[model samples]
Target: MDIKLLVKLTSRAWALDILAHLHRGVPGRQATLLAATGAGRTAFGASLQHLMALGLVARNPGHGHPLRPEFILTAEGKAAAAKADAILRAAEVSAAGLLRKSWTVPVLALAARPQRFSGFKAGLGAITDRALSTSLQRLEAQDWVAREIDLSERVPFPVYRAVNAGGEISRVAEAAV
Candidate 1:
């Protein structure tokens, strides 16, 4: 699967929530989905449009009154949602939960290239030291990132590198960009 495609699918507001809810395998009416996702009408509509565009979801033309549309997962949608469900289940922190944190995805993406603290600060100019430190620590605790001391350098500085999971996220983000 294209990591970019996954990132693009998940990054939009309410996208994962919609997918997660739909992954339940029950066709849902617009009202039901709106209630289940707790998304505002505008955001829900937008997300639905986006998912349909990606061919992950489709209208159940045979079901529901014309005034109230129903939706179901397409074959590709089911496969993608299944993968997303697995990722969420396997995560120490849910993927959606992690993305909720500011700067988490960007920081993870940069860390994939193996960066020092200073490098992170420089690369993400808007991120505060405390936020960067917290993100790095969180990622390390989750085992998505590895921290190493550079003994070869005159002044040993700590470097953060993305593990396989982090690399996976970075690839997704890269594709989104």
Candidate 2:
């Protein structure tokens, strides 16, 4: 997926979780998805709406009760869902919370190689320094990203690389984009 779309997907709470569950073949009903993702009703509804607005998901026509709607992945959604599933599988369960953060996926995706802070800032475009720092720290804390000090120059600087699960996620994000 593209970085912009990936950022949009991860920005909202429960959006990634919803996509992952749906990709796993969980029924796309509100209740079923809520149960599977363990998201609160309000957040779940918002994420579902966001997906619909993105044209990745849609309500099934002529199906189910009016009060109980069923959702399905659009052609675009299936590809996105597949990517979401791959990302979820690549991440450790403990990393789920990080995945929900706005900059996490975008940062990881950009960290396909060891990059400096400026590189990330330039790549992500709108990401602020503090936000990028925080995202990198969180990913580092999760051990998905590894920070190495580069002393090759007069001044040493830190370089971040996606390691382990982060590496896997980066690969998935970079795929077909």
Best candidate, TM-score:
2
Off by over 4 Å in 1: 91-97, 100-177
TM-scores for every candidate against the unseen true structure: 0.60, 0.94
Model 2, range 78-155, lDDT digits (tens) per residue? 999998888878888876787888888889888987899999998888888899999999899898899999999999
The models' CA-based lDDT, in order, is: 0.72, 0.87
Clash list (residue pairs), candidate 2: none
Q: Model 1, residue 131: displacement in angstroms?
A: 13
**Residue 126 CA error for candidate 2 (Å)?**
1.6
Q: Which ten residues in a row have the lowest lDDT in candidate 2?
A: 168-177
